[model samples]
Target: MKFDYQWVKDPECFEINREKAHSDHSYYASSQEMLMDESSFKHSLNGVWKFHYAKNYKETIRDFEQKDYDCKDWDNIKVPGHIQMQGYDKPMYVNQMYPWSGREGIKPGEIPEHFNPVGSYVKYFSVPEKMKDQKLYICFHGVETAFALWLNGEFVGYSEDSFTPSTFFLSPYLEEGENKLAVQVFKYSSGSWLEDQDFWRFSGIFRDVELYSIPSTHIKDLFVKTVMEEPFDEANIEIELKVKGKIEHCVIQSELLDPDGTEVLKHEFKITEKNPLLSIPVESPLLWSAEYPHLYTLILTVLHKGEVKEIIYQRVGFRKFEMKDGLMCTNGERIVFNGVNRHEFSAKSGRAITKEEILEDILIIKQNNMNAVRTSHYPNNSYFYKLCDEYGLYVIDETNLETHGTWTDFYDKDIILPDDKPEWEANLIDRANSMFQRDKNHPSVVIWSCGNESYGGKDIFMMSEFFRERDDTRLVHYEGIAWDRRYPNTSDMESQMYTPADEVEKFIQEHPEKPFILCEYAHAMGNSNGAMHKYTDLVKKYPQYQGGFIWDFADQAIYTLDRYNNEFYAYGGDFGERPSDYDFCGNGIVFADRQLTPKMQEVKYNYQSIDTTITDENITITNHYLFTNLDEFVTTIMILRNGVEIESEEMILNVMPHDSITIKNPFTPLDEQNEYCVQVVYTTMEDTLYSDSGHIVAQEEYIYPYQPVQTLSNKKIRIADDFANGVTRSTPKTVGITDKSVA
Candidate 1:
């Protein structure tokens, strides 16, 4: 293969010579002893890389991928970083408008010729002695727009999808020592048309890049499907393994370990073919849900001639997610998604988020009573799904395709991709398949979203159908159908973005055939989310009205230094860029620096699963949880007079799931001179990973009306004083006596 610049402008040539597909992301170790430890077969290429920035293709250096072409004066730029953030170019944030709007008159498949930025990166490394004999591969976690790769002056591959991992076989191109790896990342491509998400435009290798080795008898792919029977008691674990390289005389050993590390089921098989399918049955499996995320480990050990060659670990959950009775349910219980759309962003880095940052975000979500998260308009890093699975947050995994700019810029009815464009169908389906293949093993993902704001068309409908055809374990979601009702079946649910609560209610009441959810609602722009409670209240009023995800979780601002040397967060248009969305990117409950805002209080209150109603005579508690009971929470009742607490009592609640209980108020109200109020609070009874014990989950207050005290006139006060002081000389002191009454 040879590198060519023209491929950057072609939509059909998005990927070139990419490596074969493998199982969903996992760390591989050669031996069972090092299974839990870091793999020695992998090497990180995430440090500094020699870089040269060019304003256009013509200005870029020619034959830069050649092994001896560099003159050793190139600038140093950090890998896994955006060139714009490193002073090479400028970051531009535009929503529903192309960055080259006025400068160029290009269409969907063509890119700008004069102003397109090109980043040429070079890294020199040697093959590790341990991995010299093994089959080696290079993986790019993410790249913006499009890019081409060359190793030791030989063309490797080209890829355009920016969110998913792009792997290439490097063993064939490697040298004995001092091998050179070159990459040319383009700022624009045909992929950029579909990537027109409402986010800041950045280009580079903004994610991790590493090299890994594969063993001889390795498991190339593994698909484990947990299917629950009708009674929801027993589950069938179907395992399909795809082996690469040498598989003769190899034995596959599988084990299912419960959460407590107890092995329940074990199976053994001989590898006679490249792909093998096996099944195991379990009785009364512990199903997973947002409330109770019970995970079971599926360990696969490959034995070659009575010796363990490789061990693969996968976490599995047996649960059913389906649409039954016009509602979305999980594990046979109706589910409500108290979710928020999350963008992979940070203050210091644009989209180069760290694991610590992801953990913090998930923890904040859990503490704030959020049960689900939508990966906004694109798929996030592979590790994010694992965190969501472990932390018990339902996920709505979305594909990396959005063409909001098509309709907004053209102002025409026929300006979109994957709608009726046959050329874009393969790209659209490839994105969906990539997301599904990478994130299929996670039980937290309850829905697969086609894309965002791309508008409905045959391509999108096909994408939705592709998801359903591939995986029946999860439901399909696409909000573009709201734009074009011609393809109403593009989504399983009636999904809408930013629609008002009343409108949603009316639609659900009128239709009632499918569940309604606000895919993006309560726009959390600065001081936004007002009246969000109405939507949450609708969840209680109608069964078809499921909850929705908020507009976003955090502001998409980059941290930068101003002229005064003071550091602050910068949003759109701050970097001397035109056609930007400006402060519109600051729509988040949390600030860019990971600080909580006042809006989170309202979100917590509205999204809390427990509903408590307090009155002077009694307190009623409703367990809104689908599976768990209220007993795990400590309920406290407080008596307050004139907004001040007068008495308090605490007790453990025993309300079952989806049930309510009324308890008589235990506080004896004091006959005070002010109105009374009863405050009921629900708190965690035990300490958990995300929060401490006694953390308040929900609270409600009810006020008791009281009669106002009457006021006495000054004349009545004077008359009483005269009687008490025995001042009979009141000279019939005018009943309405003034200060001169003594005269």
Candidate 2:
């Protein structure tokens, strides 16, 4: 493995000497460190590094990780950043195809031989004083395509699959002080075929890198699963624990905190054997929903005899989601998801988005009446799922797999990828396992999606079955089954992309077998999303036509200086690249600058869970939420005559979910037949983790006694020969009197 790079082209050799995948759970040294809210055991390697670029493999520096190599004079590049953005290579944006389309004729599991770029990076650091004499491990959160690592002239490991965490043991290669770390990143690889998503082609290390040390007695991983029964108030919390390292007689103490920071349950476990299992019960648990997001914090304290070794914290939500009577239901009521597809992006940082930016996006999504988001095409950063769980949003977590370019040519079916090819099977299943293991504990993720747009094959079906066999708490979702019905059971529900409402209705009526949803719809490219209410309106006519996610959440635009040195947002082809799909990446309702476009107004109204209707003599308020009541919100009514406020009043109504209430309007009678308008508004009465008090939830307006005006003739004002009389007179056309303006 050290002499050659066969792992780059051989799909069967997915990873070489890499650590096994595990759950992404954080642990602290003590309860005091956990309260400080920072990791005391982890060291960050996310700063500057000496870097060198190569256009091909032949040009890369040889033996760069040798103990005597002097690399201080090399150029400095930022870690967790893409090489193209740092003035090393030109960035290329392509959709539904590989970036090397015209330059090479590539097959199923082949690589481009000529122009693939390589990046050699070197970093020098010493072990943290606290991490010495412990088991040390290095983790790379993400890297594009493929990469190899070395320390002090010894090869560590190699890995692919750019979206999940890859860790390697570093204690054996430990140097005394000022040790060298070298990483070689390849732009394209065999794994690139499975990662052909509709995004910009980028290379290098693009995510965080960390070095952490584990104590002699540590918790390796923890899985928290909640079991809810009929009536759905009580919950049975089951925990599967894995302990590692030298351990003496140990006991685990567990405690649960409610939404209001109150302890509800406590238990003690005796670790008599390996991989212990424990269960606890909570009476009348506060179930979590999008409308009322209730979360419970669980804390575990590990003690060996009389001293505390480690403490772990995790957030849990007790809600039941299932397919009940041909409709998707949460907490025993039918669910409708008002969602949008999201791509993690920024104008300045490319795919390396910041924590502040993620927080801003989540706040905007909640503010605009959206309740769900589909992590379209791939898995996002770990912080994204944590934020969703804290701020309350439903997520559809997708695996990092797509081969859309291969299937577009149906004429040559023999040339498509993963079409019963045995070599590609292991790679696909490994990608699935990596994603499921890292993200299965998130309560926001209700569905596990098999790749996207890679037409259907037996290999795709196997990926779907892997998800089903691993976890039964969540349902499976796949959209490629429409391309081939040989695997009708790939997706538990029938999902499609950009299907019309009438067609969606016809399918549900024709098949009468499964629930239906549009995985992607309402393409929101600049001033679009017209008639989007048609899809949301179908939630009433058909119980199975649940809702659809708008095409996207934000535009994928980058900032580049123009010829005049002025910065402007640039789309595809702006960098003078070949085979570009220009401006198609700007399909988000929110611009790249993090500002909302005018199209958001229509989206806000269409996706609102509450609906209000106003008339001349009556007012109607409806609660569309599946588990909330109208009494939880503050409702106010205001009336205007000719756009002037005549009367304003507050109202009280207690309408249950999926129910409506009608009351006499609080508006005065019209005396002169002026334009009378009525408005109904609903707002939150208290503050939440995501929103503030008095935030408007839903609103509607209506005008009564309105009449349509017609222009029978055109208006004319003429100034004629009066100029000769020293006093000009203007005359209005007499026939225009028939179409007089109404006051």
Candidate 3:
């Protein structure tokens, strides 16, 4: 049973021969057809398990499943969690350096033998009577690095690479009564080179794990590719199916149901082989857009021997995306991206976020009038892309290939270029391919990013080329080329991270050949980013200056109770570790506990896609609805007294398409002495977005007092009072605010 594995260029060792029963390629069901025969099973293998920790690989037991070995002294640990967070190892926060910093100098594909920690996990369970004679398999949704598995002293399998699902057949190794399962997870493997993402490095089985039985006849894989022609008025649909077991006669039926549950198109085909391709024509299909987001259900039924055995359903949208006249267009309209960068992180769960958290993120983005998102640094979970497709949000699916630790040093010392590392080339391509294959079918994904923070090179160029060759449905993105100009064509657009406004303007002014985007800017660190209005103002002046993604959405935090027994989500350095940056990880628009930060007030104000201008002193407003119509929403007019509302009115105004209108009668402010600020709000007449009742989509506010300015001479400052905690300085022209310093 020994298999030879290459260090870096081994694609053969990655394939598995044993087939899964009743499992579709992209979808799997453990229901009546797959596991109902084993009804006595009560629990799943997803929660807590017995755990043993080792500091390094050398300290771990290589043969933990030896017949005489005993794991009675092992401690308890939760599955689907990180070993570092469970008190087994210290939480390290170095951006680019490996965890084995002072100890090792290992190159690519070489594991650190000295300080690579290993985790040994064990689970004890008994098979119910119904599952006695059924064929069973174990599936791991995600696992860090590499690991070997054993069941009751018999070796089952070994696997590496943490992003994809891997299943192993376990029927041959199961016992009749009590069963013992063992898993050994390593901190680093040769596969770790491909997983150099920017987030904190951790090791463990971080996703779901389940075991189920499968039926004899099943569909192994299904491929769906739909192309819309003539501006989504007509569609050409193609489906390819791969099946397992015997099929004397096969029949496939497909139906397209519209949003109102009406059958739009239906077709049936006959098949006699294992794999077959079926193509059908759909007339006058409903197109999907960020504005409308009309979706159709694709129901597929596979029949064998005149009996329905498999039914797979996929929700699809008809849309065409292309680049025209130097602009990216979707469904024949120029696509303007009002987007933000999102890291798949949770305050209480780290990267293991639940469905509710993900849905909440989508609602927030949509409510703020944002239509796009960039999966910054790496690819998110599969369910995230599915939700984006359903919710009508555009996606920039990024691959998991970031060597920031290696390239961060190059930035400081002007070290020519370090991206041509021969050992890391295959890893980069493999990572890009993995992300592309897994996310290609999603209608929401519009761009394929090679990676982030890694300086551009031939390795990344290959990745860009691979994306162009594999699929023409989306464009490629790589922001690192702004650092290395040698490969200017590596990315489809001129994207940079954290560039100043003047620099961005100059870059666009100089090379107007491609569009410009700020991938990461206005670093929202602490109570910072007071200058967001400056960059957004530039968007109005330049059309090529498309919008960009905010650096992040939320801070990564963990749930913990304080000394007063108050439960608060904690972040880096909260565990009392040495050499840590405290509170630096708390730089999210939302607080560590998922509570909205005050910074979101600025975000909601600036991220509004529409702008309203009121001419004359009476404030007759004009609405710039990017997606919705003014008549569809209720407008609220408010006059504020120095940031406080003193006079307000709710009015109904019907605005025509792209036209300006004057209000019939304007209400005058009651308070004239105070600084009277005028504000206008536009909300849905009926709830259309992901909110209940009504939600505000656009707002405009004008600060009052019009501060009359007076020229002041540049004079020296005089110290009025100086103290240990507070200091006061005054200029000759006017007294300034006091500055406080903490000891």
Candidate 4:
């Protein structure tokens, strides 16, 4: 059957002729160098492409996907970029408002017909000689709204769900010579209503595109789970593998290596079926935590007739996150998530973020004393989760679904999606499954958020159930139930957004059945975050009050050049587009240009794990970390007289985890009459993956009140000024100033 272009507008037609789903993601390698250097078997198709812009489907060139079409003379546009940022369409930002609000009246499953933007992209390339005879596939990391693919003038597939990776097998449609790859992206679709997030509206293939070939006997999917018993003395490592292609004489071998590169466990098995499960137990296993992120590597080898065909490497951490006694604990210690909501954004490229930018964000989070990050509203790039595992940051991975616009105007009516509607159930569930499968392997992910704010419904409740049924190792989070209390069990924790500190405390005290976490709090808008310490103080007072994530980490602004060629960071409404939220998108502690603002200081002080209190004669140090000790930090003391430094000393003290100690002052006061104060600074002892040596983590100061010195002036007058200058005779008188009167 010929490919139908109308499927792009149909809500039910999400995928067509796509490859069979196996696992989230996997790669192949023939040698160790190829495994480490991923560019060997994979080809990146992220350069320029011949592009065509059309206002609507009627104006688009109908035969642009044909092989005989000459697209060489067309304009060029960069892949992994937004069409709006490239001057094809205007960028519009809105919060809880659809882009086509007043321009057109559209239903749930219907899109606008007059002004929808469409981008046609064509790229030509020849298959590499190494992958000619193998099974080749094309992977699109992300695409907006909806897109259709064609190769060599033959229909390949269509896909939606822009956040997760969409992959298609291309070996069946390729030829010997140059092959033409064409993709048509629609800015508005039936899926657009389900994607009304509080950010700018952009459309394009805004992520990496790559072509890869897998070996005959390869691991299609891998899931690793680390189980720890009480007391955390030992752990059981479970490894599951799904093998495909060839399995007659293949043997699967798994090896576990500790953080110090020492092999701890090895198991070998014969591949009889498609799925194989294996387990290994180790005594006295080192646990993983945000404070001390110890990692172990698991390597999988697929052998055909005693020869290695492919190797899969995964980083694993041994930790346990669970709810005990109505409190969330990790490794038997109560975990306080000093977290922030992060958006995958870039100043130059809208949603197409690079590895360097991802690393910089993680480093900034770690340096600011934050230990957790919530992939705000959606799942970020897969590389981000892997980096979190290596760098030790807790992650709350969320699904890509938001329907805030549905409840904006008719809020009293409470009209929302997938509530009882059977048609929307499949698409909503598919989104949840896609996110779970992709990010389930990472140990850093402790919670699976159903989605942002799609309202409470049976569809969302089913998604939460799906997560719990598939994986019982982690918890689920959803803040939508706060708006609709019909399904109170939709989330494991009592989550809310922007709840005042007093109300949070009262709720926890009243109902302690479930732990409370302000999933979204401390809105970091412009000149905002006033009195943020109130919430942080509640964490210490009530055990049920777990820490919450700030609204965001960095501002969502795009770089633009003005008419006079002057460059500036532009926010909402800057592109002269209507239905915008103005500067509402500029609510980040870090500016769009990667610079830290003043609000970060308050965040740093409130999130620090180490607590220090100073008195007149002693300094008391307390360690609140779960798995780290005070010895890992260096403490320096500076003695000041009248705010001027007089003596400096580095103290050597060892405080265990969750312990407190008091030490006497090492130096006596230099001048008692003058004001004396002491400043204590604590910094890391050694370099870590996220911070360097001597990076200040926490500090405190103590001041002593003083009384100023009182002086009495004495005046002396010479009696014989000029006449008796030679004799030098003088008379002296003393003047006293009393507390009651001065003369």
Candidate 5:
């Protein structure tokens, strides 16, 4: 039953019988289960699995999915891991070019024949008792490249688009006893050309694998959006519900819980339509922002004839992100993004970043005053967005598509992928749809990025339109439009990468029709964000100059043993791979091991929302936050002499946002000639999700109480222009008392 996998070479044939992409919201049977953040409905298949690695497609084991085949004796590999990281294949790193670019001479949308690795994986499990009579489904949260699935010797489905979740129904192939689930993952496919991200290329089942059963009438997909009217504080909560199975005659009990755990709104309604939109209006609702992450939990319970079927605890946020008066604005005021481009990576696991790492990343971002994050080249794990929502950080959710290597030359349009090519339209559209569907519900996701470095084309323009047509709450972003001006409307803003500060200012001055942002800037290579202040300074000069993202947040280096058995963080070309771009990927403000670099301090100071200045007579505070006031933080004043604090006291200054206030000096200046310093530090008065109380957010220092002029003598002897040329050396002939020793 060998069917030629010719689809691997065809860009159009990416998926067959794969389930449609859906919301990341999960469901539970009872409210208790929802509170516990656990679902009895989902059964995790993430563990050791029987595995075999093949160097190429032709070397793959035949009939490996057969019911009579024995795979228990095969080598074991972790389910949620990359084959390369598990000692099966070497991890490959190529920035813009494909891994086999110069080696294979393959065309775009074509895979290598002799070197693509294939992983054969088998896991055996029996259906849980709770899921006995339900519609069983197998979910692959994420798999690299392309893969085919089988159950009990029957072909189930095939899928691609490596970063998004792919689910397939297994009811037809289910048996009474133990079932054999086999998956064959190909290292390269037509999709490989689209997923040419700068990070290390690793292939396998690298995300969670789950088997789950849904309620008879389940909310298959859920979208919660906000509509703000006058007064701005008040908004309407809009929910789009897509239900599966029979939903008629069922009743929905929905309630909105505020951040303080109070029920603000509750309604009971009967299911009446196939896909329903429920809207609830409220006055003066709590808004969500990076400064204040106010999440209102919405609990929806489905009941049919007084029998509860499912309950969902979905976090909802009330905020508006739109273009207001030629500038990107959130809520009502023009906004600035203090952001970093984050690649989902680690020195240990590559893209398989851990939960702790995600939390660490978010906390570091928040504590360092970074309000936004650009998920550099692709969509990260779902948990990353969830934490971003909870901890309050703006996100630019990007699709898994990059054709950088395809554009061989600036004028070679024929070689570039999706360069108005009809055959490649569906693939880009699919990637966009996949990203939007999975991350649409997150409040942190303020923008949808088409992709990175794919260049501009009609296909990408159509993708922007697709995102706009599907979701109006967020804007579409594409940096490639800066490369090609054929489609000016592909991006909502004048987005660019690595654009110089002077050029950015010039562009905004000349073309203020749209807001401007450097999608990737201040290339933090080798821990150098040189002249970062030059870019951030433009935000004050022009409203159109919103902000920019640093090239990266964390360095992408892997730790491996050297010849001497000592461990070191290895970048490209470390594994003896050829044609590599060595150490070019190690460009992060933070080290590959997640330690803060010296560059992070510069970032914190440059991106800090509060501007503080201190002098001998007064201290001035300028609140740069669009939504927060200065009074929310605790400000401390310190008087120091010769680096030692002589006086310290706390003071309150309720300065409004976008406004500045100068407080008079209460302490008298010392008359004695000494090095006196005045320091003002702003810290959090209350504990935040990212930092504890008393954590300094911003500070300023000024030293004074010294003479302004330095005198070499009572009367300054001004030197003539030609004094040095005419004057004989004053003491050159004298060699002190002794010739060998100085007097």
Candidate 6:
């Protein structure tokens, strides 16, 4: 097989070590640091960087770490961006087949070497006085495949697994003056075999790179888990602390506070030299749910001889999740997830999305009445999950593993089925375990998915079993397993994608063994899913059939400048590229620029718990609105006498977004009733984030005086045509027009 020689070079060994590379006065403390504003945090390392482009890793310079490496002759590029989109390399995309499959016939556990490029990045940075004394570690939020670090030409360390944070402590090598940080990012590493996600193949330091300091005595890691029982009248709390310091004995304390800042419970735990686990129980806890996401504060203090050494605060929720009677329940109530699949992305920045973009996404989701999100394809940034916890959304956190390309052939190679390999099982199970260990403590993550689109196999089955063994509180999800009956136990629910309405009903009827959920249905790609009502109608008809999440929420368009020198949104091929599946990534309810698309109008009404459709002759309302009392919304009845509103009044009606209410108003025909048309409108009394400030959403009109009632009696006239033989057969059919004809 032809090789991409650069693909085999490991880049994780040369990453920067902040402490030895520069001088800082910041106190040496815990590894974790606050990322909030004004916290003396530094993220400016990403702004300026001297860059060198290499055709492949084999041609890259090894002396990039040397301060006098004459990088002035090379081009510069931004650190937190993709090399492909920034004019360094070309972007290549292939589905179910590796990008180099045609050129290099490499199999599992191997990568092409001829074309694997390496990005050699160098940056000059200095430590501020306040942070000069502290132990510092350079952190990378994300890097594709692998990266290596070097400080002042001295090798720091190596790291792989791109989607998660990898921080290397740098304290031994110290310099009091100007410092040079160098890094070698390989396009592929040994870990690349596991990161075969179905996405455009590109590489670079696509996430934030920063230097952080830790105090001498600090909290290393915190685990907070809470349980509420007795109908939320009592609570049990468990807190585990990992500390790093010279302190002998310590004191830890915690307090449970309400949203109003009132303390519900407070306790202090005396830590002896022998014991460190602090477990406390609370009484009368306020449960956290999607409707009311109540949270509590857990504060831990490390002390030495009664003097406080350091203080750490964590915000957590007290709730319980279960799958009771084939229904996923949270806080003892069934949850109907209104979710969207989100690929951690940006049009301009690739996957290195900023904090502002993250905040904007959360706000958009909330405003659209979407309560849950599925991290499609892979795990996202750690900070993204923290935002989901704060903003109140359930998460089906997925692992960073997708082998879509390994299983399928583009030009007719042998089809690699899921159960074909023995080694594939172990590799997939490791991915699942790693993701669960990193994100297990998060409350927003209610379900653990076993990755996506790899299809089913014994190895995939083992991954599902691993989840149940490690964590039973949440159910496991793997949609591809639905295609293979051998792994019927793969997902807890009967999940399918894009199943038509009739098929769904048949499946529900045939299999009452499990609840039905469209893990992905209603192919909302381009102008599709026009008849969405058919699927929603099934949800109302079958109690065993739960709701499904939409295909996506936003188009993956990136911001760019057009030929006219005007800033515009661009899709796959706008960057002058080949081998691009242009606009296939633009499937979203909202446009890539964050503007609401017309499809949202249909989504909003269909997902609304309350349904009301008004007509001049009658009003039909179906209340699917959950939780809210119908009486909360004042139903305003407005009658337009003729094109112009002749009368309007607010009448109290027992109506809700999720409940059915029918009301008919007797109308008095005008003397010249033909001159006037009748119009009826129903709307909410108050402005909602979703609705346009109490604007009428459902209205109907009819021109009428009063048509005379015409009832046609059914008169049967049988007609039969037969060739006279030994047998004569006839079936009578009749057609008649009725008074209430739909035509």
- Cα lDDT tens digits, model 6, 1-743, are 11223334322222223221111112222225322323453435777588887877669986777766656556788878888778887666444556666676666555567877789888777776767888777777678867777776677776666775666775554477877788777776656655666456678898888886665655565556676654777777776555566546666656666766787777887665332666677777766655556677665556666765555656667778887777777887667777778877776777778888887888777666677888876878777777787777888888766666655553222344335466456546655765676676677888888877766767777888898997756888888766667778888878788888899999899997787877777656787657777877877788667778788877877777777889987776666555466777777887877778888777755555555565555666565544455555555555453345566656656765455767775454554422345554445567643344455444444565543334444454333443344344343433332222222
Ordered list by lDDT, greatest first: 5, 1, 4, 2, 3, 6
- Per-residue error (Å), model 1, residue 93: 1.0
* Candidate 2, 1-743: lDDT as tens digits: 37357778777776877887877888899778889967667999999999999988888888887878989889999999999999988888899878888888878678888888989999999999988888889999989989998888788899999888889998888899888988999999888888878778889999999998887778777778888977977889888887896456888899999999899989988787768888999999998877767889999988888678788888888888888888788878888889999988878888887898899899999999888998878888999999888888888889888988888733468767676777888888888888888887788888899888888888888988999898877888889888788888989889999988789888988986888888899999978999998888998888888888898899999999999999899999999988788899999889998899899999998988888878777888788988778887888888876677778887657999889989988785454345667888888888977789888888899887654333443534335655566664444323221222333
- The candidate maximizing TM-score is 2
| TM-score, candidate number 3 | 0.84
RMSD in order of candidates = 7.0, 3.7, 6.3, 7.3, 5.7, 9.3
Task: Write the number of the candidate with greater TM-score, choosing between 2 and 4.
Answer: 2
TM-score between model 2 and native: 0.95
Q: How many angstroms is residue 42 displaced in model 1 relative to the true structure, after the best TM-score fit?
A: 1.7
Candidate 2: residue pairs that collide: none
For candidate 6, the lDDT comes to 0.66
What would the per-residue lDDT of candidate 3 be over residues 40-132, giving only the tens digit for each residue? 322268887888889876687766665346775779888887787778875554445545545677654456776678899988777656556
Cα error, candidate 3, residue 692 (Å): 2.2
- Candidate 6: stretches off by over 4 Å: 1-37, 40-44, 66-74, 193-198, 273-276, 410-434, 562-568, 574-576, 613-626, 631-634, 640-646, 651-743
- Local distance difference test values of all predictions, in order: 0.86, 0.85, 0.69, 0.85, 0.87, 0.66
Scored against the true structure, residue 113 in model 5 reaches a CA lDDT of 93
- Provide the global lDDT of candidate 2 against the true structure: 0.85
Q: Report the C-alpha displacement of residue 567, candidate 6, in angstroms.
A: 4.7
- What TM-score number comes out for model 1? 0.94
- TM-score each candidate: 0.94, 0.95, 0.84, 0.93, 0.94, 0.81
Off by over 4 Å in 1: 30-35, 707-743
